[model samples]
Target: MESSAETELGRRVASFRELGGLSLRALAAAAGVSSSFLSQLENGHTNASVASLRKIAAALGVTPAQLLDDTSVHTRGVLRAADRPSLPLEGAEKYVLSLPPLRNLEVYAGRFEPGGSTGSEAYVHGNSQELFLVTSGEVVFQLAEERYTMRADDSIEFLSSVPHRVLNTSDAPASVVWINSPPTPNESPHAPA
Candidate 1:
């Protein structure tokens, strides 16, 4: 029997895919999944693996957590730390720092373990303005061919459309705060986004 969570995930996936005007085949192609598998997932006949969920979320222009979220419960208010949503990235943990109904801005906090990275392939989102601040330790931001090494209290601003990646090559952990103005639909809801 399908669990409620699985049913809800299927519903959310179908909803988002429809909202994006993507056909089942189109979404499957974009997410690198078989159409039959996606169909089964949408029908709640099966649950997606985390890797599959991540791929689907990326194709849907959202985070895996967003796909699993009961967004009806999200509201604008002072969100307590414990109530904040978190996403585990590759060797890093990302905390969503802003309340839902995000419009003008979105915030995220990332803690990168030593040698952690935001993957080798850089990611690009809509053309929103972005600010990245290194709150603790050190980090390297690779934007296209440009590279910047930032340390504690250091900050940088750039257009979010640039293909970029974040890395902590140091032996110690690193923390960063990222901000985006006029949230974009294509922005990933975790890590440096």
Candidate 2:
């Protein structure tokens, strides 16, 4: 019999595949594995090695941890507000709201002082999406050639594989939650450009 963790892993794997609308054959092909192996994994009939899990995760456009999570709790796997991780940025303080050991998605709670900004540079990553929700104060986001001003309770979602920046324009400290999918490979969550 498979361990409970392994069972949870299988369930998450299946869920993610279904969410992505992938057939077993298609997922197997993308992950460079046999359909039989993928089937065994989903059925909890075999233990999946780390290499195989990584391949499946890459093919599914998510982190391996996301594929292993059992998000059955009432919080939907969210980290409590007080338990968020704090990451130092170049000009602002970023508090990560999502639980780590994450898979396809990441959520953050960021606090920025007046006149602070994420960065002035433009960058791109591979196959990533991000969302920002202004929980308090005012913020400005520059995406490509467009400029957007966000107030409290506002939200924005966009592809992270483009040049973007966030600015705190209010006199009071601004707080927002930043969520991203598929943690950028080996990128450091606290690294500020």
* Candidate of highest TM-score: 1
* Clash totals in order: 0, 2
Error of 1 at 118 (Å): 1.4
Per-residue CA lDDT of candidate 2, range 95-127, in tens? 765443345666667888888888666556554
lDDT of 1 by residue, 1-193 (tens): 9988888889889887775567899899999999999999998889999999999988876778778886822332256878778987778888998644355788888899998887768887788899989999998999889999989999999998999888998999999988988776754665458
- Look at candidate 2 and give me any clashing residue pairs: 66-103, 104-182
**Which residues of candidate 2, in runs, are more than 4 Å off?**
1-83, 191-193
Each prediction's Cα lDDT score? 0.83, 0.74
Choose the strongest candidate by lDDT: 1
TM-score of each candidate structure, all chains considered together? 0.58, 0.56
lDDT of 1: 0.83
